[model samples]
Target: MLTNACAIIATAASAQIIAGRDASADDWPGMASLQTVLGHSLFHECGATMISPEWALTAAHCVEDARIETGGRAYQYARADDGSLVRFGVLSVAIGAADLRRRGAGTVFPLSAVIVHPAYKPEKPEAGNDIALLRLESPWEGPVALVDGLTVVPREDNLDGPPLVVAGYGRTEEDGPGEEAFSQTGRQLSAPKMRLQEGYVPFVETEACRQQIDSLVARYGLSDIYTDVAISPDSQICAGAGTTDSCQGDSGGPLVYRDYADPPVQVGIVSWGLGCGRPESPGIYTRVAAYADWISGVTGLQIAAPQP
Candidate 1:
């Protein structure tokens, strides 16, 4: 997830990568990174969910800066000096029936407009109801699934079981001191099931998180380390160390709960993690259930409970 503090820097790095690659349709994973472009150059970046042939759900912060584009293997954001623009694009557009994924098939349409949440506030990264809706230029012609609505999974009731799948493309580790590099793209990382909590979820303790954060800051002097101890109720699901963790570039990806007989249903959106996957740090996710009404109202899609 690109918090306000790290948004600018990450956007630049990502733009370079997006413009340099030739991504394919099949590479568009359900919950993948979305790169915004301006005149063939990457401008901004955010995570997106492929909800339907023509629709994607993502954080408002991502689209707040550029126009939406699809069909590329991956999304990239470029820095301002690289001639990139960081701004939202389009207001609203209907989804025309088209299938860009088919080989030898090329489809192009203009976005009508963008619909952002009325209450979305970018400053508060924790109050992560920062959701948004993108009306595709044309309706995608294929099968797409929507994420499931909020349904509580009791922490103690479900434990020592199968590992929950937390997927994203963020930094593999905390930003190191004197380090001036970003993580690679298209690399899907997973954290197995760890500890879960009902009330306040504890990430790596502040001291520990600070140690890593301080170390990076001292070396890099960039102050990129986000060692915040608490996550707001709106944005994160407290899952402690064992296996499950979130990292940079993972924002907007899904923290899915998969069942044997049914497909995986997304329970949360990758929002942030403590000190880049430290041993005790639990990754935070934007609570999908908290914004069910907002999500449904904006997309005109119903949020249903997943069937077992």
Candidate 2:
């Protein structure tokens, strides 16, 4: 029953992007923007930091169907074919955009290996440990930092009160589609801090999300089951309202705690949401703290302090 239900929703809606535009070097707190290219066609994807230069974290769903390529090839296609070759691994990374309207000055690197969470189930559409790690072919020689103080379990305190900075190159409106082109670096956008329901972990209401699921199945014929969970291990955060939401292309970007004095820590990973910030539909995110051990184990890096 759960499997069948999951299949129903998996067919609904298109992939949503959580981040949009590129940030000037000063916009992103510690790390510069991250850009990924995959496949021979070089489809562009977004991601953020777990540790600078060592491990880059993002959504596993982004790479589930990707092919690996190089940055040069990817960019060439983007220039020639637009984003038609985006399915390949061609990608570049840049940091500190002097002009917010344009791209920035960060190094573009090829992805050496993509290690996704072992428990990630594409068919479930639940965002369960939906996290992934990108091993850069070379170290980043820019301003990057690790997201620290994340726990593996949900905290009892209210995580919604603080003002969160949600940055990505996702579309400004839902279902409107993102920029038809790709860039070496991404932009940083912010959302007003909405209330996070810590105790009330909402599940995907099959009935509510049915229309989306039905359409997706009809068009893509996918068989994954989707739920309206506020936030799950799958890294999806549900938000609904109007234009104030994450859209297609924001996947794997960071939902950050930029209010901190020392460094802005990545609290969640943008995965999926219910209709792009619709009313009553709070945005969901992959809780970064809950997977600290798993991330550390996979990357072989020391966990940084949370408040530092």
Candidate 3:
């Protein structure tokens, strides 16, 4: 399965990890797990990053249909084809959870509001504007360490120059049923890891990323529903190294620019990729830096524009 977002014709992407190592206990304090309850079980669906005590950042598609109303209330359910509200499950985020089964006190927070980018296209997530923010029902009272390295605004210049890190509780392997199966059934099969996983990938230059994706389309004789642009440098970041890349359960997760000496700065949100860990194809992420103004306007928290 493709581990990113959109499915390209017969090509596809899921929400998890492809090839990554198990994250140490203190690797990422702000790292979070986007989960949904099913009967007696809470399953990890996507990865998220806590940006503030009451807010988290994730990919729009990961929230299914949770949206903010015109009057600022959050509508918490997806609608059926006939326009009736459908409650699949309750969505929540878990912090300070190295192993999801052993969630610690004050680590989980129920979401009160969901704000998906207005221009987000569900059918074509790869086209960009794939970011979203979730408001917690109450301020996070988890361990202070969890909020120590909150994601911040990214640098405007040299996005491709930084060493990047991606962490999630998504699948460590990239094996799954195809996208056709997901369309038939409302959900994709997730072989998620119980423990968090982290990996590093190099940022691919925009033109090079586009050429690689185009080559994949031609090689597979595939047809794409969203072909306006395969990879937009202004809205997306492309990064991968050999087979070290994010996969199925990693969507909405942070792709941060990390330097050993300083706190990591989130640069992108995991969106989509042609296939997981394919050397020739790289993962595509929603460029967080590009949406700084929109995020600030929605959150009412001042975020400085990237400086040269």
- Global lDDT of each candidate: 0.42, 0.47, 0.68
The reply for model 1, stretches above 4 Å from the true place, is 3-29, 41-44, 66-111, 150-162, 176-235, 240-244, 305-308
Best by lDDT: 3
TM for candidate 3 is: 0.82
* Order by lDDT, highest first: 3, 2, 1
lDDT of 1 at 260: 35
Single out the weakest 10-residue window by summed lDDT for candidate 2.
191-200
lDDT (Cα, tens digit) per residue for candidate 3, span 1-308: 13222433312233555667777646575788887655555656678887768888888877747655554444446558697767666677878666666666678777888888998876467767878898888798643222111235456475666788887766655664312112112343223676677788888999988888888767755545447444788778888855777777788888877786866677778887766777778888887877877776777766653347
Give TM-scores for every candidate, taking all chains together and pairing residue i with residue i.
0.57, 0.63, 0.82
TM-score of 2: 0.63
| Tens-digit lDDT track of model 2 for 133-247 | 7776777766654463432223344354555656655444553433333333443322211111111122333344434434543554443333332333333433332334454
Ranking by TM-score: 3, 2, 1
Candidate 1 lDDT trough over 10 residues, lowest sum? 11-20
Give the Å error, residue 178, model 2.
Answer: 3.7
Candidate achieving the largest TM-score: 3
